[model samples]
Target: MSSNDYPLTTFLADHSIRPIFRLPVFEDWLFWLADRTGIQALFKCAPAHYSYSPGTIRRCTRHGIHFELDISTYHGWMIYYRRSGNRRVSDLVNRGDTVMDVGANIGEVTLLCAQKTGPDGLVIAFEPNPATFAQLSKMLALNPGLNCVLVNQALGSMTGPVTMVQPDNRNPGTCTIASSTTPGKALSANIPLTTLDQYIEEHPISRLNLIKLDVEGYELNVLQGAEKTISRYRPVLVIELVDSHQKRHGHSAADIVKFVLQHDYRVTDFSGQTPFGIHDHFEDCSLDITCVPNECVSR
Candidate 1:
């Protein structure tokens, strides 16, 4: 069976698999009992990401947005379980804005941005892995009339073809650009790689409002490629920086903070209320930060 067939999720969807632990009545009863006992908070702590069949699509009538969720994979399942399409994107994007989703897995953020941007706006989503790209394309097709474009190329500091390394199993979102010094198992090669600067120069946009990047760890390469564009447009950036992931590329959060400082930007939490700086803290942790321009944040 082809990877695009989405075998596991397809099977679950058709069979409606429910083991004893997943039986709704018993699970719901347990939750109710726990809530009554004031111990539900324990259940809430680091709750394992929930998974559903591949066919879960959520529609928000109030926001006039709807999109297919990639419930087959771990990250996709968690995002769908959270019901927040691409975290904080709903807050940053606005009507008629030009936005970019650098590592758009299954087009969750892409569709949300398209809905928020309305008919007059434009959203470009980039996903390099072919299997995941197929899923993203399928999601886009399921939700029509959205002003969005899908790119099957990886964005980085240079313009050339690069191999995409994807790990085995159900987690498709872990695909990343493979480096020479970095060892990997699965090999998906010959993917077209380009810089955001070059892409923008070729496909020019008058205004860029926001950029959402979740490239696993190669955030610096992407940011370097987008330096010219960010300097030119000064768009609000939402980037994910995981310490373990960054270590693979021989860098740290402090390195990213230095880049932010060079770009005249400040790092703030998702609420945008608390501003922080790069330091020895937050080591060995996954961090999601919003990089805003022209703000003087305490270092």
Candidate 2:
């Protein structure tokens, strides 16, 4: 109970951590952690304070790619941790290959794909959020060596202005074009929308293959709009399937898997090289999955 408590002082002296406890920086960090992660606030980090002025940059050490992030938000935190969700997409990319990165967020993964595809290859990256798009553009500018075409449009089933709802300022990557009635609304933006099929028909690439979709739960619509592209190219499909998010859009993971199967493609988890069938229970439908056309399974 006293300042000279034998056991406590001895333990601190032995470990030499008393200076750490005495530092105001440590106290400040504790307070900030309590505020940021809500360790003691009984909730997650507050999402309202996620926005910051544009042009802030963070370098991802793992992938050696410089990403522009608004550190005042959730994505900024992800950058702090160097959170790379699925690097497996890079494995599927070959030199001189053409790739479509739908829902490219700040283009971190897109950067990796660009690197893999090399200068001769084409990397079409799309980000609908204006603020996030600015960040992606900044990254592209920082790395002039990357041959990427940054598109400020939402990839959907139609070519028009589409409204994407952002739940909050915390996570810019969560924006989706699905209707609000099904999944509640957030701050909305009217973005240019184009189907992959239409875009390919108009601006034909030398070889259209290897498409990655991380468009929240709007993968269904993008796929529907890309019917012709898929039928014609049969590119490897890398997609994220969130069951709850799909339900919010009035669909299910089963529907997405069914769509892939209907196209004569077999499903597999992102990390798994073995192919899965529609009837096979995926066990985890919440992560990125690979759907390859049966014809290419042996290749």
Candidate 3:
């Protein structure tokens, strides 16, 4: 039969393509087939490097706010938007609290915190990589209504100059610049660093409700830099602790636990499918370690 004369159902059946109703249960199967067969090429595509202009715009969602962002940084944008559940961190977030996202990394968590906190709450995101910061800044400009403050600086134990390295990958901003006792990889550049205490002192912050630190291997120094802030604000701290990454910087998971515990905070490992109950013992080797103030334990 001629293409125009063929019945739609017959064509789809002959092509072995399932109808949309069956998609929900087998979406992954379809994606896998498409990847293997290059069937995705049949769809219209945008340039991979496309980016959104730096300006304000309204995009609707189930949440109450609309945000602006560059298309190139869409991955980061999605991470913030799709977060769900009453995770320990989410509890404090629902109360319209302030958040600090060190090593903001394209501002995904930063944007998530912004949306959760609403207009009254504040989100201070620190990203030092020039390219990532560029996209992050553009996103901030796009969402002018959110109470977000962007700082292009690295967080470390002390305020001083440090080498900020950029990897050769597409997301060059993932490069880490903190000092390494054992050499592992080389980075693109070095940049000056600052302490979180200095940042809060410079800005008028009333309270710190949450803090997320993911500085590649520099997580320990970032926590140390914010010791004063942790003591005063007692914000819930979520940090990434890859053993290999920490070892490069002469740190370990145990050391991190000691540091947070010394500051009167209780550490919890939530890397499992089910949340650990009060009686459960937390494992020390988790990649993501979340800490809450001892006083806030029963809350």
Clash number for each model: 0, 0, 5
Q: After superposition, how far is residue 113 of candidate 1 from its true place, in Å?
A: 1.3
Q: Return the top candidate by lDDT.
A: 2
Worst 10 residues of 2 by lDDT: 40-49
Which has the higher TM-score value, candidate number 2 or candidate number 3? 2
Residue lDDT tens for model 1, 1-299: 33234443333333234333245474455446545754422222222334445544433222444445544567554553343436457568889999999999877778878888989999999999888889789877777888889999999999888887765356767788886545455557689999999999999999998999988788989999988998899998898878777777777766776788678887776677767675547578687888889753444
Worst 10 residues of 3 by lDDT: 41-50
Q: Cα lDDT of all candidates, in order?
A: 0.73, 0.74, 0.63
Q: List candidate 3 segments past 4 Å from native.
A: 1-92, 178-190, 271-286
Off by over 4 Å in 1: 1-18, 21-70, 83-87, 180-184, 278-282, 295-299
Off by over 4 Å in 2: 1-61, 182-186, 280-284
Ten residues in a row with the worst lDDT in model 1?
Answer: 40-49
Model 2: lDDT to the true structure:
0.74
Per-model TM-score on C-alpha atoms: 0.78, 0.77, 0.67
